[model samples]
Target: MGFDWSAAAGTLEVVPALERLELLAEPVASAILQLDDERIGVAEIDPELADTAAFCEQYGSPLELSANCVVVAGKRAGEVRYAACLVLATIRADVNGVVKRQLDVRKASFASMDDAVERTGMAYGGITPFGLPGDWPILVDAEVAAARAVVVGSGLRRGKLIVPGEVLAELANAEVIEGLGR
Candidate 1:
């Protein structure tokens, strides 16, 4: 069957695995649903596509057609820690340079998969900026945000959320940035 937001809403059930893991974020889900451009579709897929290339190929969608939101852990000189960063599937965030500079941290690294899962309330490979902590620094690729619509993580490894790109930025309170290299 084709995706229907209303029907999906009526069901309104978090995937069993996500629920059991306690990884679903209600605020993120609700924020995504509240957008005015709410025509986005959500669907689950095979686990193999958790990586960008496989996901694009399997779905017949371009890597440029999707946005990747990542959570990076930064430790500042003063001992403060934070998660940040977002990019399109076609590009990778400059973790050691730009991201570190932005966060004013000497070191920045991708959050460990377990740490990402535990703190973000999202499964590994399914973390999106949608329901992330409001204080986190969210960066977005200009091109991805310019798309009419783009697919993003759905808080579960096996599912994705398709929505207007601009709306996704709004939901994440993200700032558009440049120089995300492929």
Candidate 2:
């Protein structure tokens, strides 16, 4: 059966993400239009509850159904590389291990909040993989890609996106990596 967004929505109302572009960051809205995927939906929420734990608690959503997209920065010699790691909120991304190796860098760490926000053109708590720079790789944990449906940031503090996991697997720059989250 398809995901029952209504049941999982708690007191929030969900509508087609494409139909509510005003609620998303510009890049995210454009990406959603380009993807033209109908299964994506958006729900408005209080900005104060944008963080994973608080959002899930306030919305009555399962923790397992939430995904976090973290921006990582790695430096090799004089060059810096960026990647987005998508993993289940219940676990942390293996930033210094698998991701570091994958990026082929000496050190890997989460980008500074200011840097991440500036680079992604999104709010501090709302950076999402959907609208990341085209040149940056997106590392999606296998478990997240296999989930039925997941709640992710909408590139805006006041909203969230509901999407089928397979859609993330199909993004052009996405790589499904096993054990990306640990």
User: Which structure among the candidates has the greatest lDDT?
Assistant: 2
Q: Show the colliding residue pairs in model 1.
A: none
Which window of 10 residues has the lowest lDDT sum in candidate 1?
Answer: 7-16
Residue ranges of candidate 2 with Cα displaced over 4 Å? 1-3, 6-10
Model 2 C-alpha lDDT per residue in residues 30-84, reported as the tens digit of each score:
8999999888889999999999999999998888888999999999998999999
Tens-place lDDT digits, model 1, residues 38-118? 355665666667676777777666667677888887887667566556677777888888777877889988888888787
On the 0 to 100 scale, the lDDT of residue 104 in model 1 is 81
Q: What C-alpha lDDT do the candidate models reach, one value each?
A: 0.65, 0.90
Which residue pairs in candidate 2 collide? none
TM-score of each: 0.77, 0.96
